[model samples]
Target: MTFSPDLTETLLRPLLRTDPHRPRLTWYGGEPAGRTELSTASLANWAAKTAGLLTDELGVAPGAGVRVLGLRSWQVLPAALGSWWAGLALDLSAAGAGFADAVFAAPDADPEVVAALVDESDPDTVLALSTHPLALPAGDLPPGARDYSIAVRAHADRFPGVPVEPTATVLQADGPLGGDAATVADVIERARALAAGWGAQPRVLAELGVTVRTTAELVAAAVAALAVDGSLVVVDPASGHAAGTVGADEQITVSHPF
Candidate 1:
């Protein structure tokens, strides 16, 4: 159950080597946001492009925090991994998100809320995601906010990860259940533990709400799925698709439900 402490390398490099084209993520949502599947290579490419945006375009450095205010969709995976690719941390708190260097918001997020968050966090950059099935950029962004979908497309498809910092802070998931600042190695260790608990389960599904922001639920679920050589399925619970239906269709073996 040993794993690489470098989160980016642990998540992408091995998958790229072992089964690049194998399906890794499947997302199901409501109409116009149906089904989307990303292969290992596809997912890596997306993360790399996103990393390019963070590093080359936005000047995000290692140990910086990127606040993502979005639902559990296919895009979040790439966004999270991309942050890791740039050696950046993810701040998944429901509050105090404005303190991060950059912020990503979903379209469903209330404009007022986003504006307030921007005022509160006063981050240097804010990118609004349309969350379309086709991954289209938002046409009408809030003032001073850029469109993430459009910006990410201009980046390269591959990114050499930043130097590994196993002990560096990578996540902040302060919550009522229990929360702490975790390092890259700590996250990898937690993933391995979750994988061990899964035993022979083949696929891990994320059924938690976007509001349930926790490192264990967000990062660990995907890592554990990959640790077991299984795909991670992220579903929007309000997508008109039932959990049981998706589990049955997608061959889900385990779930981190709300």
Candidate 2:
């Protein structure tokens, strides 16, 4: 599955145009046998809304840096994709919050902890996600901080901004050797390579805390799955379900740690 240099053109737009109803991501975790699924259309919609929130409401401009915490949930997918859609540089490194223009964290994360990490940054720049299975809002956020699940809902379902530059830096991270920045072209190419290795339309199962660590890796994995018109089944290590059992149940064709 070869891809264009543009991330949106390669990974996102294609899915929306063809087979938009097909399930792209399926998550299994949370209390009381929780299961949630997002089709290609649904994922794209959320990404667009998130982009709208960043650009329209938060006043974050293109090429700005956005740091994301808590990578072990389905909500991270739309947020990561939306950042790219808005042409923001995503930093997934452990020490990214210091240099970020905005920070997104999980709902359960302590506000004080995130506040301490963001330091002098504006409290409004911090957005916390509920990670609700039904996409509910996270209520009772700290004063000045934004609720992602609530605020994002007010945005349009389609991004009304300019297309992202293919050469723009999309991700900043620590590569296998050292720190590196990946452009949209680089990410697309990496996704293509991953899809090639996974074979045609492979159903991949990955454990969030174990197999995946950073949101960048998860985004790459998602693009790989989408490139081949496949799907991703994500599970938390704490789900207490054996990988083999879940793989067999989900009919997963591949299982790899990201």
Clashes (N, CA, C under 3 Å) per candidate: 1, 0
TM-score of candidate 2 relative to the true fold: 0.87
List the pairs of residues colliding in candidate 2: none
lDDT of 1 by residue, 1-258 (tens): 332335676777887897899888888873365888899999888899989999998888777888777564457778888888888888776564456777777665557767876776544478777656678666777777888888899999999787655567777765421257777767766667667766553677776475235433655567667766778877777776676788888887776523
Candidate 2: which stretches are off by over 4 Å?
Answer: 1-6, 31-33, 107-113, 117-119, 139-144, 175-179
* lDDT for each candidate structure: 0.72, 0.73
Candidate that would win on lDDT: 2
Candidate 1, poorest ten consecutive residues by summed lDDT: 210-219
Give the per-residue lDDT of model 2 (tens digit) for 182-229: 787676666667667777778988787678666656766776787678
Clashes in model 1: which pairs?
A: 98-121
